[model samples]
Target: MPQHHDPGTADAPEGQASKSGFRPTAVAAVELGVVGQSVGVTVPGASESVQVTGISLDSRTVERGDLYVALPGAARHGADFARTALEAGAVAVLTDDAGARLLALGSDIAVPVLVVAEPRSVVGRLSRLIYRSQDADLPGPSMFGVTGTNGKTTTTYFINALLQAMGKKTGLIGTIEILAGGDPIPSLLTTPESTDVHALLALMRERGLDAASMEVSSHAVSFRRVDGVVFDVVGFTNLTQDHLDLHGTMEEYYRTKAELFTAERARAAVVTVDDEWGRRLAAQTELPVTTLATIQPGSGPEADPAGPAGADWTVTDSKPRGLGTEFTLRGRNGTELRVHTGLPGAFNVSNAALALAMVLAGGADPAEVQAALDSKDPFTVAVPGRMQLVSTRPAAVVDFAHNTDALARALAAVRSPEPASKVIVVFGATGQRDQGKRPSMGATAARLADVVIVSDDDPHDEDAAAIRAEVLVGATDAKEAEQLDCKIMEVYPRDAAIREAVNLAAPEDTILIAGRGHEVWQEVKGVNLALDDRVELRNALTARGFTVLQDDGIES
Candidate 1:
């Protein structure tokens, strides 16, 4: 419990910290002055001094001399784990008033217990301090952020690839995994918890990573998951109606995303003004904005001149080639960047362009960034689940197009003109998410694809049938609106749905399995079962006597 050490003191063993790239930063747990000044959260108790080396939200990961942050959990109070965490070498405790009261029933609690009004809110600032991201000498990774309803994952991936292609050692933190200098480390949240984020940044710095491409989810921004982190460059993909349950309204959602582009969050920005939301966001941001558009750049129904998106860049002459595409990127600076990408679709072209602009904003020479694209392996990155092609012959593609907008794009991308006969799409609605998108998604599939097989996606306590019914309503509505009878089938499990979609496909026909792209598990009734669309689609295709094409490692 001694606090008479340097704030930068490390209690970690000689080489123990180096393995995970952890640098222990200790602070006297008795000091809550920073928290008081930051968010007006006070520690009412007369605290005894303890050397806190780390911070943790979960008791399971608590290290020796750690400050266990006891936040209010959904099931129970996190203070319940305070004793457990302390038992596992936690030196002090930080929590809410209720959590403090709960800890008070025990006389054995000797460590400093600081009760703040909003424990979760201040945890980020505290974590930033404890992890040394705020330290001047650390010079942490150059963070690049991508935010939107769709294309966040793909854009971040593209940004990471671009950074790597430019010869910088990079890390990636997004929906899929945290790649430390291109090494894959599994992740749970799109944007990790504040402590995890700061810690990862610290790790990336210590491990010699020069840059990182991170997905900035609106939830993370609203929840203060990214409170203390700053980005060198940020990109905005178009926003849509999603996460309504968390944000409550599209306006609130937009504002939350807008938080990232503020001078406090990012230094420079690149935004795709294909939608009005991005245009509006670009106008409001204090950072310098480089607007991009896949559609009409400066005029017509798509352009919003009233907002900030008076396009500075546009994707022109974009020609899709199977799983890849070639496009001419034109910027207001009069630089015509010719881009060839393994990533398919106009949306991907927009993503690559935004990535190029972001890297340029992040201090990469535009000519060099453009030159990286033409290198034999330039921009040949295949993002998992974002338009991931898993098969050939009766071609099957897996995409993480869970929402209506994303689904429409995925369908359009795979709906080939000549080679493919029928575009058979198998998709499902996630339970307990934006229910409004169910019908819209179904309708989009109905309008775009030749056949639709609706199935389950993370049923998570809701009846899969009910969610499917809502999506089916959209399919029905599409049929009614167009006065055309479209083929629709309801499948309970996703594997059956994949098989059905594959079975219904001909050699020339395309099979698109939307939702659950690179996700390796299916959430059902509280348990997550191993299930991946790419794997399942491949299995289904192999069972149908089709020799699935060899998976080229570097290419899709």
Candidate 2:
């Protein structure tokens, strides 16, 4: 059994100064059971009790009275930094059994030590307990979570815009920004840490917000970043090959995502059964799952119509108009409504249907959902960098499509309008992750694009050139003896590569910039430099003096 500490029992001395801006409140302590006797400790000071003000894994961010969590890494153990954490004001340490043994040799630092079976697994729970004990006290807002391999950001934007149209105050959290009451803050991760997440929720409560939409990534679920938070409704767009480096296999990745659908978290689920995995997920969960289909060919015979059956949703007769998309969303009840969205690609219709289903399942009136859809044109809340068309003459599209599945879909969507148009692609694989997908990504681009430009995308600590080489292997494998016309270029710098692709593009051609969509920074080695692909494309187009009409159809 687990025990929690009471903040009231471990009050600081009357004269002791506080370091953190947030007060050391008994409220926080009561929330996270920080008090207790030593349980299986090896260090001399293991028996001692200490009040942990906060929890942090990074030594640099540790404050006085904080408990530093030392996790083992491939290159170095967190125990290596125990001394540094102590010097930086960590009063106690939480680590594994082996780490406790190593700390016993140290005689100078006599801090309380807690030995746990697995610190990584418990870190999220501890963080949640510490920060989100009274999460219900936070204002209740209609919360929506968008999860899928692609279009999460865009779908999140659509939901936010629709909610705002209904005159509800809304906030957004995704790969682009952490928005609260319409204030935009730069984001560090797709899903923030559990502590930050609860803190944000508390802030939203303070702001009197009506609704909030978030993009939940696979990493967030796997790491339990959303452990204690409640979602009114969870929306699934689709899933594809991605993050193989973190999750060793596709099944593991799917399982990690499925964790969000458990009885404890989401009240209801809206899943897009566009892929086989989604259908399987719908079958496994007992939650009132609403199935949505956007594929033009109509629900496949293998698709479980009974799942999304009566009163469910599907997109029909989707047509891409100038800078926008027009489609008809027909519900199971036979209610047909027209929706014109600024989002590009045929995939967006599916995304819109998912958002609509989630809103309806969350108790929003179906008629209100329709009114929201009709009150405004869809392009108003376009997600930046997702299927964003920058030029008309050469028809350039900047998307976050990184995997083979997403890339293939993007290419197919762009090629649908102009079958004979020459397609040029600019893309690169991230270093230190999913190395196996490198060849697949390359092959997908080479198969679709007349010319493929391989460049660097967040090559952290790995050689950029080597990363590009792996991508080239896929391109070479894809190039058959009969089709030697497909050209491949290796450019180290991403900006240079984008410029090359733009220069190579001619009128009636399409340049597809894949990966790193809406990301404002480029991660190189260990540093994050300011870089936006959309801005770069605009600059390149301007320099080349290309006079192309901006397609406002795809939301930015």
On lDDT, the leading prediction is: 1
lDDT score of model 1? 0.77
Residue 221 lDDT in candidate 2: 90
> lDDT of model 1 at residue 106?
61
- For each candidate in turn, the TM-score is 0.90, 0.82
RMSD of each: 5.9, 7.3
User: For every model in order, what is the number of clashing pairs?
Assistant: 1, 12
Residue-level lDDT of model 2, residues 223-248, one tens digit each, is 76787777889988777889989899
Candidate 1 at residue 272, lDDT?
A: 83
Give the per-residue lDDT digits (tens) of candidate 1, residues 1-556.
3212111112222222212223333333424444444546454455433455677777767788678888876557888767777888987787888888989876579776777788887888888877776467768688899999888888888888887777889988888878876457666678777877888877787778889999999888977889888888989988888899788899999988888998888888998887878877877889988888777445433455553334788777877665778888787778888887887676777787888778877888878877777774456687888887777677678888888888888888787676538989999999999888899999988998888899999898888889999999989888888976569888868999888988888888889988888877787886777787777778788888877767622121
lDDT of each: 0.77, 0.73
